[model samples]
Target: MLGNGLLKGLTETARNFFGSYVDKDRLTTIQYPEERAPRIEASRNFPFLVYDGTDPQAGLRCVSCLICEKECPPKCIFIEKSTDKKPDAVGKPQFYPTRFNIDVSVCMSCQICVEVCPFDAIKMDNDFEASATGRFSDLLWTKERLAKSNEYYHHIHPTEAADVDAVLAAARAKAAAPRPPAPSAPGGAPEK
Candidate 1:
């Protein structure tokens, strides 16, 4: 009648209110901490190292290439290559990150670290609950803290991890293949 326009809004509000009780999908509000939303495969927050096997340091795929650290726009990543080489997940004896650290307080979460890493060691984590009480110690996460199992990486990003794993397996197979011996000279003398 007089308030036909207002009546429509009121009717919608009533419908929404009743639907919230009956319809499982009608609830729009998500209770934090207790009720977590569905995981988004593409979502990323902070950078974490991906390690395979039981040992985090030895199994780390980083290879101390420093690509991620160099590409980080904020310069939040710091890494020190180990002098001693260790067998990595891909069966290559490579230098590991002895002093890898990330200033999470200054990290912008641009995901450049994950993108520039050639070894697939770095990936962005979906966990956004990195609260720090102390600035220096708490905010600056070391290699041990940042390291996560390969399974964790797969859990967070199944498609990306699968692609990376395929490349790693190929590399390992190539490295394992026997190299052909060098050819000898015309007079049966080995080439210098």
Candidate 2:
């Protein structure tokens, strides 16, 4: 019975080995670099900061909350909040990251950073070729290097991007919606 199971496994391997020659569809191998396979949309590599509009710095969605940095398993992400506030993608004044860095070498690509980001500022990038000659400096990705456009995010993960866009759009609409006037007290004072 033990030998029978081994024989079955060998038979399947042999069948697959011979099938490639007989069946053209069975030949799955492709020439790397020159004829690379199509990228899978759901495949993720590393975390990238997503910006809304044309300006990467101005339109960045990150409010420098430090949630992603704290939640990062490898402690790869580092962030410094700005003193002054600037308008974000939704035109809400927020404190942006003055200094943001991610050590790619230490990162395990677990997508935890992306998951914990409340502002939807971070997303997983499909770029896998982050090779470096030097160990330290090259692997440490600065805010400038990490910032990517929303269009690029959409291009990589269309379905997820579309959903994020819808949610963001709803938030924008809610923020833009005129609110009812605050109730005033009897003696020309605003209600607490």
Candidate 2: pairs in clash: none
The best candidate by lDDT is 2
Find the 10 residues in a row with the least total lDDT in model 2.
Answer: 183-192
Quote each prediction's TM-score.
Answer: 0.83, 0.79
Residue 83 error, candidate 1, Å: 2.0
Candidates in order: C-alpha RMSD to true structure: 4.3, 4.3
- Which structure among the candidates has the greatest TM-score? 1
- Candidate 1: tens digits of C-alpha lDDT, residues 45-123: 8899989998887788788888888999999999998899877765767888899999998899999888788777899
Judged by whole-model lDDT over C-alpha atoms, candidate 2 comes out at 0.91
How many clashes in each candidate? 0, 0
Per-model lDDT: 0.88, 0.91
lDDT of 1: 0.88
